[model samples]
Target: MAKKRKVVDAKRDKNGNITDVLLEGNKNFTSTEKALGMTKSGLIDLVVVKRKDKEHLRTRPDGKKGNNLDEMADD
Candidate 1:
């Protein structure tokens, strides 16, 4: 089964980039790479996309902005 928890929050660096994300039930933030790994392993519900030479995680399309990576980072 796919993971039910979604990224509800985020942790960012001084550059204002999201370095980590917080799951629905997780109190501590998890690295984006780890989350990406989980997404690859079918443990978490996400998509891996290549941008230039790097892979990034994105939420499945649901026509909602609340769960978008950018909004989550604003929290």
Candidate 2:
């Protein structure tokens, strides 16, 4: 099986929300749609959630809170 990808870094806006995430050694920011697609394909080690008619990306049920996208911005 192929290795799963991870968002090692991220770019945030003024509100501190993640706008784009860095995939390992990627130079360009990954789009949300692309990330969602990857999540569906199981390429990325994250979860996809649909809420309020929109799709949101989040980490799996891991014990580490910092691994979550929201906290990844801070770290």
Candidate 3:
């Protein structure tokens, strides 16, 4: 059997962009923070990455490729 995909209820803005998402059931806040590698204050730097085949590419704050285009980082 194929694995089921989890669905989330999203809140969008007037432009049809996702602003927030909610998952089902009650989850522990501490556990969620720990799982996301976030502190209690929820302060972290995020990097948006795109995938090209098996390689993951990093994007800059402006959503463009940086000076080095050879997969800077990965999870």
Candidate 4:
């Protein structure tokens, strides 16, 4: 299989919060902004969430649906 490529290179502030994101590959900030209908700076608000209330979200008996694909789709 071919190795996966990194899609974003993040720049963080002094507090370690991401302030900017440089998209990898052929896409530039202008192109991404145009396509996404928003400025590149708008993407800085992206958050990573961890559910502390629930051990897991999925309730499938087989446990196959708890994988990464299912989690990503929920986002």
What is candidate 1's lDDT per residue for 4-34, written digit by digit as tens?
A: 5677787778887778988888889999989
lDDT tens readout by residue for model 2, 1-75: 798998886667888767777788788889767888998998988789999998988888879987778787774
Clashing pairs in 3: none
Give the C-alpha miss distance for residue 50 in model 1, angstroms.
0.8
**List of clashing residue pairs for candidate 4:** none
Candidates' TM-scores?
0.84, 0.81, 0.27, 0.27
How much does candidate 1 score in TM-score? 0.84
Off by over 4 Å in 1: 2-4
Q: Score each candidate by Cα lDDT.
A: 0.82, 0.81, 0.29, 0.33
For model 3, residues 10-60, the per-residue Cα lDDT tens digits are 334476433332333424122222322322123322323336643221222
**Highest TM-score: which candidate?**
1
TM-score of 3: 0.27
Q: Which scores better on TM-score, 1 or 4?
A: 1
Give the CA lDDT, 0 to 100, for residue 13 in model 3: 49
Winner on lDDT between 2 and 4 is: 2
